[model samples]
Target: MTAGRKRDAVLRLLRAEPLEIVARELSVTAADLSAWREAFLEAGAASLKARERDDRDEKIDRLQSKLGEVLMDNELLQAKVDRLEAGGGGPFWVAEVEAMSPAVSISTRRPYGLARVCRVWGVARSGVYRRRRPADAPAMPRRRPGPQGPMPDAALVEAIRGVLLASPFHGEGYRKVWARLRHAGLRSSKERVRRLMRENGLSAPVRTGRPTGPRNHDGTIIPESIDTMWGTDMTAAFATEHGQVAVFVAVDHCSAECVGLHAALRGTRHEALEPVRQGVAERFGAVEKDAATGLSIRHDHGSQYMSHDFQKEIAWLGASSSPAFVRAPEGNGCAERFIRTLKENLLWVRTFRTVEELRLALLEFKRTYNEHWLIERHGHRSPAQFRRDQMDTMPLAA
Candidate 1:
């Protein structure tokens, strides 16, 4: 009920002929009328009591309002700190100002006070005070002094080079290299690994950023379990004797394992189905109706993936066909990423004489990749190992 209506009803209950009579006229229960009358009488009594209580209530309201403002200011200050950390690199980040925003003064400013910023960032007051040391005085080392880890710098570089040389694949980054070093019982910090790689020219070439524009939609593509979702895509490669060949790939979103791969001269719908067919047979033990029940296939809107044959086959396998949004390749990023890896490691690096040769190479690469490629997301476990580990813990399929 509106406050005005409730107030009018309470007033009626006070001086009406009878509570039931007033309640009946207003379609409200007698109990509610009696409760309202009691509340009104209590409030009226309170009004006549110590005027100090009125002052106390008003003070409480003012304090609550002030608390809300303080909370909002804290949020804005937190965002400012986030902006500083996210600003990447800048001299302005040291103490005084931000490049994108106004000065965040470390002086006695109320919000960005020196003591408060230091507390939030966990910087020692002693270290911050050192900024006032004589300009020509020996400057603090850019990084903490001495070596960071137990391993010496030279030994670490040699180990990093050994990892790169021993790997059968190309384009492995310092993180994976670091993981491999640990697996070999050589411990080193990730930052030190990165530094040594950069200094010794052992790191992978920096990758170009993905083409940027406004994204139409966003969601994660990875699934929590194998066979829950799969992504399939096609890319073309050149073989010396075959001239050009189409490579179809199907990948499990959870494991990053190449469940199926195939190469053919014709990029037909049937050819596209080959990888999916192979995956179903290998992973589920058959390619008959409902073989892939509960699976969803994420693919692009290409003619082959959207073909009547392709859709029919997916349905026959008891899998739902999920066509990626137009112009949004990230929806099929699992397949897209595997294609890039395939190219960098095999298609672009090695030459095949025939389609058959390329097919054989793809099969071999799939095995190697499943057994060796260290996915950082899985704590650097190889795809095959991760699948086995998770499968051991996962309940048996019904």
Candidate 2:
């Protein structure tokens, strides 16, 4: 029964029967039945008020959650718009927007996904899909009909674009851009500038140089300590009369120590791992009698590093592997520096006719790197010597 009906039944029984009999029949205590009767008479409105208060609290929490999500989405949208306004329309932004935008499925009503979105917004789907509006159309000056009507100057729009292109803020949005144009003797509003920029697709920044090296999404910051981390990267050289050759290089993070270098006509995971494995293993054996020191191995997020085979090999050596962020080479600064050094000292100095010739040159360089080359950061000692000295002084635990 409803609470109100049950309360009414209890009240009727309480008046018709003895207290003990009524309590037993109703499966409620005499005190509880009396409280229900008194509550029905005295505070029906108060109980309803309590229920409404709970509902309001629930609604407030949901709205707060929604507000937080909306704020986050707004921030992301603003970032995208800012990037577009700046003219940074490289693949990065496109890829980023594609990843962020919600995937829509429309196998039924709309001809295109974008069209469907426009329809939902109460805009004509066909018009949005066509997007025939010219970039400088909105910026064109309007003139009233008279004996002598004025015409919009096309040269002005071109001049505005030229100013924007020469500007460092070419890829930026309208407010700052308008101020820049005004300073350059061009009178234009921010909206007019934005319209001109959007029409020509001159608003996005182009990727000018080589792709920045691999990046890690998890924010794996590079270490500052010498020997705390090491990075390696591969660069391919043209094959001689035989085939294409690849060079594997590893360099120390803090000391600029050339840890290892190897060359092969074609480098597989095994080829890359062999030289590194040998160099590290020899170092371990050099300090064999002492406790092992931890080493961090950093590399690009290539399939070679991420592969199961590569991970297993590193695990066997008891060293941790860290990958650089996607398209971010600054994290692997040492490796990049080494690559430049190798190109200057070895590759640039002499051209190799074969893989064997390249291998021989790399071997000679590796020996000098480990035993002969003195780095100022290492107090004028070679990598091997510095490593030996550090190990000799390191305390051993009982």
Candidate 3:
């Protein structure tokens, strides 16, 4: 598709090279090379023909001028369509085409056909016809015009509201609600639940229009077994005595278990290493050298996580450092997700008087979360239960 590609082949043909030779050189078919050579010679021959003014020439000139006008009109119509789409009401371009009929004509005596006008403006012919129907014609249906579902719209919306309220977590989407409904012996499509949630404003508010770029990591971060990979992250909360304090957490990638939680007055390499140490002491027994030899620690490129001290400590404990992509928190989503849960159920709701108070609260929250927080990925099992079940099924000697 590069410029002068066919011309290069045609020039090679004109130089007396065999069509097959040129095609082989260019990696194109011999038929294509022959076609290009024929077109080039025909264009050259057409230019060399003797010409004079006559009726046929005059007719061709008139048609060329008309064609130029038609092309210019099409360009203008396209510009108008772009403006309408960007300014809101892009879908109503059929009405715009009908309104533009007087100005967009083939000639003074003959107006452009509705079909031609619709095509130029990228509007559908059916849309144009529907817009121009008799005033007394029946109106279109308000909804998508389909048979009713087993559940009525109002009932579905109420059901959706119930699902949202019953969930212990925030921001559970329609897909989860649909699954929950099916588990409760109700039947409905995911799209129907989505539509009902959207109409009633029961869906979670989410940020939109984020600049999407190429992703560095496109695979799952979750590992297949316990002690295989662990994700650690840090967040902040305000305390009456400390003003602002940092909270470090470590979570297992397989079971989503919050293995460690620590709140501190300052976030440093030493403070960040506390969670990893706590996790190793409890999960790997006595925190001896190489206790977590097979674990992979997933963290972001934070000052503490990337520090030499932190890397040395993780290696000493027998885990390898695995930092996520720059500015992408999703790479360490297990820890990131638990931080949100921590904020919603505790940090954002409670007022702590001191860093020690926050630390104690974090410890209490971690215990309850491991025992009660439902992970839908593991069939709504708690993290502690999931880890126990997974460890029981696995014969690994960790």
Best model number under TM-score: 1
Predictions in order: lDDT: 0.84, 0.62, 0.83
Q: Model 2 segments beyond 4 Å from truth?
A: 1-227, 286-293, 371-385, 395-398
Superposed model 1: Cα runs more than 4 Å off: 1-144, 396-398
RMSD per model, one decimal? 19.0, 22.6, 17.5
Which of the predicted structures, 1 or 2, would earn the higher TM-score when compared with the native?
A: 1
- Candidate 3's residue-wise lDDT over 245-327, tens digit each? 89999999999999899999999889999998899999999677889999999999999999999999899888999999997
Q: List the residue pairs that clash in candidate 1.
A: none
lDDT per residue as tens, model 1, 237-342:
9988878889999999999999999999989999999999999999999989999999999999999999999999999999999888899898899999999999
- The number of clashing residue pairs in model 2 is 22
- The local lDDT score (0 to 100) that residue 343 gets in candidate 1 is 92
At residue 162, candidate 1 shows an lDDT of 88
Residue-level lDDT tens digits of model 2 in 190-209: 56566666665655443477
**What would the TM-score be for candidate 1 when compared with the true structure?**
0.64
Report the C-alpha displacement of residue 104, candidate 1, in angstroms: 31
